[model samples]
Target: MKQLYDQRISCPHCGHHIFVSLDASEGDQDYYEDCAACCNPIHLNMHIDYAINKLELRVDADDEQVF
Candidate 1:
């Protein structure tokens, strides 16, 4: 797996497309980034699955409630 990766994702707040840099060297990560278009917080959860050799990224709005 690559140590560094770039992913294009849409902002949950404004639906703006943006590029995010992911660092796989750190294993799994949970972080927040401000959307460029709306300036709203975007929650990012990154998980590296060693068994499948895949990187999973989940993006959502910071204010979203989980049911």
Candidate 2:
């Protein structure tokens, strides 16, 4: 299916705003990226529900996985 991915989310640790580009056409996925502000590792989860047209993203650090 087609997808639209455009959203800016701030890092929870350093509060640095980063543009997240998630491919909604793909399946549910998880990945890791570094925060440009703090240079810390971040676990990124992209949840796209095609049935409801919903997109959810959760980003966190190694120490802080929920916040």
Candidate 3:
């Protein structure tokens, strides 16, 4: 099945809303983005399965991993 999966994630640095898309065909399993409000880097850990059309998202850097 084909779908356009997306999620709204908040930036941990500035609490900004970010829109992320799940591109299974392009192998976009995991990625990161920047916060528009604070100009800080955001780390995104995503897992997408095309077969079941399931998407899991984890945003921001770890407590020990500084930006």
- Provide the TM-score for each candidate, comma-separated: 0.92, 0.78, 0.67
Question: C-alpha displacement of 12 in model 3, angstroms?
Answer: 1.0
| Better model by lDDT: candidate 1 vs candidate 2 | 1
Tell me the lDDT of candidate 3: 0.71
Question: Could you say which candidate leads in TM-score?
Answer: 1
Tens-digit lDDT track for model 2 on 1-67? 4586877888878999988777877778899888888987778898877788788888877584565
State the displacement of the C-alpha of residue 38, model 1, in Å, after optimal TM-score superposition. Answer: 0.7
**Candidates 2 and 3 compared by lDDT, better number:** 2
Query: Which prediction has more favorable TM-score, 1 or 3?
Result: 1
Order of the predicted models by TM-score, top scorer first: 1, 2, 3
Q: What is the per-residue lDDT of model 3 for residues 1-67, given as tens digits with 9 covering 90 to 100?
A: 4556677888898788878766656555566687777877888876666678766677865546558
User: What's the CA RMSD for each of the models?
Assistant: 1.5, 3.1, 3.3
**Off by more than 4 A, model 1:** none
lDDT of each: 0.94, 0.81, 0.71
**Worst-scoring 10-residue span by lDDT in model 1:** 57-66
- What's the C-alpha lDDT at position 54 in model 3? 69
Model 1 TM-score on a 0 to 1 scale = 0.92
Off by over 4 Å in 3: 50-52, 63-67
Question: Roughly what TM-score does model 3 have, to 2 decimal places?
Answer: 0.67
